[model samples]
Target: MSSSTEPLPKLFTPLTAGDIALANRIIMAPLTRNRATHGSDAPNALNVEYYRQRATAGLIISEGTQISQQGQGYIWTPGIYSPAQIEGWKGVTEAVHAEGGKIVAQIWHVGRVSHVSLQPDNRAPVAPSAIVAPTKTYLESGFTAVSQPRELAAEELPGIVADYARAAENARKAGFDGVEIHGANGYLIDQFLKDGTNQREDAYGGSIENRVRFPLAVVDAVANAIGKGRVGIRISPVSPANGISDTDPQAVFGHFVEKLGRRGLAFLHVVEGATGGPRDIAPFDYAALRRAFKGVYIANNGFDRESAIEAVESGRADAVAFGKAFIANPDLVARLERNAPLNALQAETLYGGDARGYTDYPFLTEKAA
Candidate 1:
């Protein structure tokens, strides 16, 4: 569709981020559907089909996979801890690979954004401080206010880091191409990073350097488990998702990104503004953060076909991750290439549901037929 004078657009060109090679720059962002196997909390046939349908994405970052039962905040999400869970995820990885797609596990730990019922033995959730987040977690009954959390002891920090490393290893064993550390959306790592939730005076929570210590440690351990090239991390500087905020995100994230640059990780997936909300909900310089990271920089949060092309063509972002768009369009890459209309999203089925909104989204070719 182009002449010799114009080269292929960067958005559709091949890219190598660390060890993972991609056919295009369009990526599928992690979306939690709460549709994992009910009792096991493992990926099942539905999950496998759901991902397989969207394998056209250059890369698929799996939903927030809990590293351990204690790390869970919502019901019916998948985990990489148990043997059965590992086997269950193997089916998913195989399906994605068979479709010639690269996938990564988004390893996660929800700090205080959890209900007591979701915690291990109904114990209180743990966080950097004992403060409860002004958020609600999805449960079997319905959405409920998150429970008060106990302050995590400094000694327990190593164990949490170890859990992340184990999850990375488990992901590789389950045939994942890599792992993406979930450091965004007011999750465990985000709780430790922001000043609002992290009121601890201990070494893990006082200053910016101290706050970023645990996240970096987890990065080190996960990279050690799998190769550094097989690891990426997602961060939200100003996103107040799940009631997280910082007094000065620019200074905090600037230093954090600078430290990440030295690690030579695969990529940095950043939620530029408010997670799942307005991109300009707060004033923060995402470009500065992008410049700080040395590897591929993935820009997320509210991007369309035109903006995606512009971001990649101008080198503002190496790639663009689409969440809701991918949910509504399985043949998103082809649709974007042809500038085709995307199917409307079924809002009610965004969370826990059957194939109606999950795998039943018709392909572009099917519409033509």
Candidate 2:
């Protein structure tokens, strides 16, 4: 179908990414729910129900799943490193697929945005440099400042890249349709991408080329592990989330996106504005960045229905991803189709909880009744 003839309210529009055809363009952005089973860090039945409820999205990107024990920064977050964890994720993927939906796993590593209490053996978090994250990570016990992270040796970079590669392989084993590298939100990849966090003088730091090396390596590794068509990456060029800031946001991210475009990945998901708190401001123009990256662009961050439609209609983005809106509206696609009002998300139950604010959110039909 031609882009012009595609119906505006057709939330189920088909989109083709290399080899895979999506049932719609409404991609579910990866969101951290922090509801994994304690100690086990495995996905539970509630997690399954949570994802299954939102299966109407053309594609569902699972929350940031840790690649290893050391990759976790928050309490009760799920991991893909263990057999039980893989089994747990299998249920989520199977449930989504059972409803004729496609899903991808967003593999993530928190880097220095971690507290000692959340680290393995209560050890320091790891990053390209010894700089501590300027933000705080939330825990059940409350929020705490991030501890100073140990600088990873150059030799250790390969292992970390392998961790992401292995996680992509594991996602395939878990029966996911694809994998999304969480290179955004000041995570491990973002820490390396931004200049403020990466103070190393080695090949991984100093110039923009050097700073983007680790993230590029990760992209190449994961793309190699899974075919390039099955791999995607998420980036926030001007994000200040987790105290991440780059010297020249436009030049650095423009080059980074240009380089990434050459790899022929499935799509590039760009989150505009501050991902976490209000501190990290957007310094670069998003439209300019969209022009630089010559691929399927999924624009995210604080977008409403009108703006989302305008983004697509204006050619600014191929699609728009919703976070909070989808959290409280399982039939989000239907609401958009009917131009109905969305349920406002309750601030209290965003993370670390059960079905109260999760699967219990009534659909538009139920609300009308």
Candidate 3:
């Protein structure tokens, strides 16, 4: 849109985010495709091919991988707990690395965003409080309402933190470039962070500092297990995904990010407005968040090539993450480079499906032919 005198966008430049070195500024965001091995809940050959096809991305953040059985909220989503699961991921990492791409495991715990059927021993889900999320979880049958979660005891807190630490250790064993703690999207960390969901008088509830305790504990444990440079966390202060809300997102998240900066983590991935929704869904100062985090700032949500370029060249974001765009375009980086048209996304096949929408999207070369 500019004159020929204007400089090219830096979206394709190479840079390093903590320990992980990227080939470009265009990143592949973590997407949940329920295609893992059915019973084992581990990454399989299909996932390996899927990731390998998109290895041209600057960095690939793997789908939300549950840290434990209790962390799982959806079926067929991969986990990083068991030895078999770790072995399954090793193949994925090796394939990505072979293609000169960097990948990080998104260690996750869905917290109260799960149903009873998905829990261990068919028990109720756990959360900071006993509130039921006004959301649904996809099961083998269909999408159903989330179950009522019981309040987790103080003693159980350390075990959950341990699970996060163990997941990071397992990610290292699985040959991942690093691990991204899934602390966003109204999950466990977000549930505890927002006062709308958490209503307790304990040390983990009430004020902003008290609410951030559990999340910080998990971050510290994970960073201890892996180096700080190998760790990053995702946060969505104003996002209302999965029925999450905060009375004061600014004050709570400001304090949270300030504390995170002191830890010297790799990057801070922030979902600007709402998860997969409007960017102006709420009144938020994303620039303030960028200022708070001293490390890399990866901006996500509704970004096109031009905006992505502007974000990087203007220093608003160190990098930009593409979610649905990457799903339909394996060679997304190349397509963007040439200003080529993108493939149409098959929305129906986005979830639990075979290679039709997963890896069957044609490349630019294939389309040209």
Candidate 4:
């Protein structure tokens, strides 16, 4: 909306974080469309089309791609460590670049929030502690209850960090402009950061500094594998998504952010409220958290055009990532620029589909085409 023909909104301005550059501040949040299993459990032409259609976004963060077989939790989600998987992503990166867009792969490791069926040896998933959550995972059939996990030994901790670094290298080879470490959403890293699930007495748990140690190690690994300027990390400080809770989110995340800021990564993307839930519940000092970090801040969850503009203008956030909006309106930047109506996303076809709600969503210019 910084264009003269459009509304002069802060969301339309150009911004850069470390090595990544954006023509605008509207980002396409990572989304799981769940069509990989029909192909090779890797990216295919369908995945290419889905991201290409949304190239209008300033930055596209790919859906959580498992760092290894052990990192996988949901069926049909892509992985980044295999040669074939890296090859599969080539078309996606090429297509996005062809449209003059920038994208990054989000490397993930879903810890105990997984099922035995999704594990490497049909064994229990590993975590900082052997805790089970009320979370459910999507299978080919439908959502199933999550299985309990085996607690990871202190010796095996470095191996998990190596997987993240390997995935970062694979993302680079796949032609991704960058890679984002999935340290949020009750995954392996989040499980260690928060005190609720991380009851271990090792160096990786108990106190906030010790809790953030592993996540910070992964950050260092990925930053060393790729350039620090090309690495980003996402965190859900207060979000209860996937049954994750922090005893002291402020102290925990404050220490986490302060530590991460020193790493000089590209940016920090946060799920402001419960991931995709109400924002006003149990408020925390988000602005202080924003100021604590010296790098770019992406405010996500329940953001619309008005709120997005307000956040940027008020200097509360440098960008905003939209999930459902980007899903329904691929050219969300254009729609927001002209302040136009959007095509509502078909709730049924959000995942595991051909192209109905995927690439077939019409742009504003194509409404009558």
Candidate 5:
């Protein structure tokens, strides 16, 4: 997203994608604020208030909520699996809706990008292969070494897909307008898509076809459980964040993107760079993927207001998602609309805190009041 001098740029235009409609083109990219109930991993009042404050975004994709106990990676992030969790999220979706906003739950599973301490019963985190990511996972104590994970048994794949489907249904029951499968940022789905993480010789690995098998299966299951038109997916084609690398991201993601388009998803959010990092670390044909997808393509990562406007106007993206920019400026869309100065984000309080950096960011009206 880029900053601009002109007001009412292309970024503010309304758009419709499948069953979901946006009042503007600035989607709030899901940011893991780590403010959930720690022990239960449930969405709480803080999470509700945080999202409600940002309801002006065209669409608010909630922070990546784990789909199961095994899916958790870090402390204090919410889950959608348990009955209590579903009830918890009901408050959040209701709050957002009360403010006249649309929101989708970003269902996630961290795969090998986790530590034993984060897993149930201190079990090893599961992944496509037993590869240990050179990544660290945040624990209540602090960031700790990510342990090597157990390779998911071939028979266990279907259960994971089932979990996703159930989670999608749970999301709807929790009052979310839809669900966005967390297929990006080197999570479970990304682990299977990229060759570096998936080394299995079985039907779920080896060739690109085999590698993408489980991920696509998960998508189909989720789509069937929830209407395809209300489902979305997020992917990082060339990003090597979280110790993930692909031998050929272009070919791998090109194939994946084309297959995903065939599912008639609501939208496809593509992270063009390492998650929350630089864009030029690798060369990728984002345009090609956009052309291949044939649906609403949301370009994310490293975008300012002006660049976001350019992307929507130039037809490079149907919308642009803003992440960190939304942390401090809950009224981000309003500020962008008025071209107003922004409040600085409190970096120290970003991950875990009270309403200080979460919901206390004053709206423009609040400042005047």
Candidate 6:
């Protein structure tokens, strides 16, 4: 446990990447808090308060906002393509900025983690190959086993890249400081990057360069739409979530990160563990990947206060992002400054409805009484 009386180290150090300057090295990782309204997937008042409460972090990555209707994977996750949705996100950006916080929108596509009910006219989900994910997606109604996805034709690849570009434009319109391409956790981008899911033999698969083509194209398009200084990419090389795995992960991810570093993007966010499973099972080499990426690096996955601080102090990472911890500790920056104890998150209330475990968690000052 961290001691409250110890003199605080310079954990609140300022950082500069490209044109943006952050107040500290702690960031709030994008977390899906399935509180969007049914049917429309629009952000509600609770969503506003949820983000507003955690405005003290150096940077806040908004939950994975779907880039298109087909990009959705879970029920009640927010979207960025609609006017109402953009308006909702605008309010969130404004609130955070008012408190001197910077925010980035995470654009996503779920690929095969989607259900039939969520698909286009009950069509099969889309992927690089016709394979079903080895896992199921949790929904409001119930869990739905993943079905084989329709392999994307070469002609369809360009449009998917365009969708990511358009979403980056939408984030700019919604007043975000930047955008983070969600290429991690077995989502659409990861599905395209991993050989276990992408069995294509054309220009898009069969080799390490081919497997990373789609994700790189999407990143290039996004960086073009928004300036490279305002774009970041997140990736989890060994993630088993949503049934994604890569053979020769070192070669694949090493090439990916090296290429991204040349792009001069703002930062690279790496989730080092099996993001959705136990830590012991993850397979990527964080130290090797860190050496591969030359730009600013933000490390995520199962970090506590001391570990997070050590990561920065020891030069292993430029910053650290928190997921579950930020949910209960709204004033996380303040808590770290004061060396206060953190609030434990309730697993049941992570997704789905209302303020019970969402906006109702008290600050340490309030909890002390």
Compared with the true structure, what per-residue lDDT tens digits does model 4 show for residues 1-369? 255585577788899977999989999988887877554578998889888988878999999999988999888899898888999899999999999999999999999989998888799999999989789998877989999999999999899999999999999999999998998888999999998899999898898889988999999999999999999999988989899888689888888898888888898999998888988755778887688788899989999889999999999999999999998998999999888998887989876868788888888778856
> Tens-digit lDDT track for model 3 on 287-347?
8888889899999999999899889989999999999999999999999988889999999
Those runs of model 2 whose alpha carbons end farther than 4 Å from true positions after fitting are 1-6, 9-12, 276-283
* lDDT of candidate model 5 versus the reference: 0.91
Off by over 4 Å in 1: 1-6
Better of 4 and 6 by lDDT: 4
Please list all clashing residue pairs in model 3, or write none if there are none.
none
lDDT of 6 by residue, 139-252 (tens): 877666876788889899899899999999999999999999999999999998889999998999999889889999999999999999999989988868887888777788
Give lDDT for model 2.
0.85
Estimate, for each residue in 1-369, the C-alpha lDDT of model 2 and write its tens digit: 224575654334678765556887788899888899888998989999999999988788899999998898888889998999999999999999998888999999999888888887999999988988778887888677888899999999999999999999999999899899999988899888788888899999899999989999999999899899988889987777788887787888888898987888888998887774342365567777677666678888878778887777778888778888889999898888777888888989987878899889999889889
lDDT-best of 1 and 5: 1
Could you tell which candidate, 1 or 4, scores higher by TM-score? 1
Clashes of each: 0, 0, 0, 0, 8, 0
Give each model a TM-score. 0.98, 0.95, 0.98, 0.97, 0.97, 0.95
Model 5, 23-121: lDDT tens digits are 998999999988898688888888888888999999999999999989999889999999989999999999999998999999999999888888889
lDDT of every predicted structure (CA atoms) = 0.94, 0.85, 0.94, 0.89, 0.91, 0.87
